[model samples]
Target: MPPYILPFEKPILDMEKKLEDLRAFSQAQNIDVSFEIERMQNKITEMRREIYENLGAWDKVLVARHPQRPYMLDYLAAMTTDFTELHGDRVHADDRAIIGGFGWLEGRRVMFIGTQKGRDTKSNLERNFGCAYPEGYRKALRLMKLAAKFGAPIVTLIDTPGAYPGIESEERHIAEAIAVNLRDMFRLPVPIVVVVIGEGGSGGALGIGVGDRVLILEYSYYSVISPEGCAAILWKNRSYANRAAEALKLTAPDLLKAGLVDEVLPEPPGGAHADPAAMSATLKAALLRNLEELDATPVEQLLEQRYNKFRAMGVFGEDAAPAPAASPAPAS
Candidate 1:
C-alpha cells in the first residue's frame, strides 16, 4: 500500500493488503473470514518465494543499497553484546567513514571493522556518504593489526561506494594507504571473515576485504568498478550503466559463479532492510558457523588457505586470452 515500494516487495505487500481487506469485509458482514485469511496467507508465502527466487541483477542491487537496509551499526547493535569503538589513524584526524574496535558477538570476542554510511542526508554527509578516506583505511589497518596481536578473529563488514577521490585524499596518498591494507590483511596471522553487507565498490571494498572466508549477502554486490564508472570507460556514456551492470556480473550470484565469493548469505524477503533483526540473526548464525570451523583449524593452515583463496581468483584459462583483432574482410 506504500508508495515507492520495490517491485519484489510489491506482491508480498499486495497479498497482505488483500488479507486485511478480506478480514474487514467479513467482519462487517458477520461471515467466516478464517478461510479467506488462510488463502491470502498461502498467496503471501507463494509470492514471497517466487519473488526472491527470481530476483534479477538490478533487483539485487536495489536490495543491496536499499535505503533501509541494515548497515554495519545496525548489525552490530543487533548481534554484538559489548562494543567499544576505537578511533584515529594516529597520523591524522579521525575518519568517521570507518568504525572499528572490539566487540562481543555470540559471547565470543571479535574485532570488527566496517564502513559506516549514515541513514539520512545530514548523517550521510558527516560519514562522507560511506566513502572512506585515506585516514579511514589507515585506521582499519591499525585495528586489524591490534586484533591479530591480541588473538581475536577479525570481522569486517564492507559497504562503500568506494574510497574518497577528493584532492585532499589524493594529497594524503589514498591509493598507497589502500594498497598497504590489502597487503597487510592478506597475511595477518588470524582468522578473518568478511561480509559484504552492502555495496562493495572497487579497491575501497578490497582494501579490507581479505579473509579466511568471504561471504556476500544475497543482495550485495562486489565489483572491480562501479557500473557507472565501467559504463563511462567502456561505452563513453554514463547512460549505459544499466548495460554495464549486466555485463560486469557484479551481483552476489555472479560473484559466486565467478569463484570470487565463498558463500552467499540469504537476506530476508525483499532485503535486509525489510527486517533488520531477522537479517542480523541470519548473519550471526552464518558467522558462528564459519568461526566454529575456523576455530577448529590450525592457525597456520588457516593462513595458508586464506592466502591460497585469493591467489586462485582471477585465474584465466587459455580461452581467456583475447583473440587478435579480427582482420577486415576482403574489400568488396
Candidate 2:
C-alpha cells in the first residue's frame, strides 16, 4: 500500500518531495548540487520536528488509525525469535480478530495475545476490521488461562476500534463474554502486561486489557468510545469528532496524567508508521523491562498489585459542599 499521510504531515511530505526531485535532477544533469541537497535535508528535518511536536488530539487519532502503522503480527515478527499461533476458543470457531500464541521473547517463554487488524479490503473483511465477537473474547480468556497454567507471563497488544456491534454479536452475548474476562483476569496468577498499540476503543480493549502494567504508545489512544461515536451521541454530528477527541482524555499523555495507564511508550518522532523497526525495538525493550520487574514480585503480590492498579482508576474529586445557597437568597 502507498504511504498514508495525515493532513498535518503535508508540509513534511512537500519538503521531502522537493528534496527527492532535487537529488534526481542533480544526478541526471551530472551537476554537483551537494549544498542544495544538504540544505533541503536540514529543512525537512526541522519541518518534521515542528509538525509532529504540535500535533492535536485529532491528529493523534489519525496517526493511531494509519493503515501503515505496525500491527500485532508485525511487532511479533520483529521482537520474537519464534512464534506458534494458537487459535479458537475451543468451544467455538477460531476468531481471526483475536490471535494468541506462545513465543520466545529474547529466549524467555511468554504467551502473546492481541487484537488483529488487516491491511486491505479482503483481509479486513476476514479480520472483521479487528472487531471481535463474543467468541474472540472467549478465545482471549482461554489463552490467558493457558498462560497462567504454564506460569508464563502474558502480553496483549490492543488496536481495535471496538467489539463487533452487529446483531450476531448481541445474539452471542458479547457483553457477558467481556465481563467474564474482566473478572477472570484479576484472579489470574501470572503477570499480564497490556499495551495500547493503536485504537484502544471501548469494551473491545478492556476485554483483554487488565494487567499488572498498562502501557500506551505515544500516538495511540484508549477511549471509552471512538471520537466519532462520542460526537454523534453528544454533539449530534460526527464532524465534532475533533472536539470530542480533545474532551475524551484518550491520548497517551492524557491517559498517563489521568492514571489510566502506567507508562507512555514513545513512538518514532513522526509516529510509529514512520519507523516500524525503531518502534518495535522500543516496544521490545519496554516489554522486557516491565516483565523483568513483574517477575521479581511474588505471585500473590503481583495479583494484588494488578487488582489494585485497576481499582485505583476512575477516582474522582468530591464536590465541595454548596455554601447553603445563601439561605435561599433571603426570601423575606
Best-performing candidate as measured by TM-score: 2
Clashes of each: 0, 0
Off by over 4 Å in 2: 317-332
lDDT of each: 0.88, 0.93
Q: For each candidate, what TM-score against the reference? A: 0.89, 0.94
Kindly list the per-residue Cα lDDT of model 1 for residues 289-315, writing each as its tens digit: 998889898888988898899888776
Query: What does candidate 2 score in Cα RMSD to the true structure?
Result: 5.4
Predicted candidate 2 versus true structure: per-residue lDDT over 110-224, tens digit per residue: 9999999999999999999999999999999999999999999999999999999989889989999999999999999999999999999899999999999999999999999
TM-score of model number 2: 0.94
Report the lDDT of model 1 for residue 251: 93
- Per the 3 Å backbone cut-off, how many clashing residue pairs does candidate 2 have? 0
Which candidate comes out best when scored by lDDT?
Answer: 2
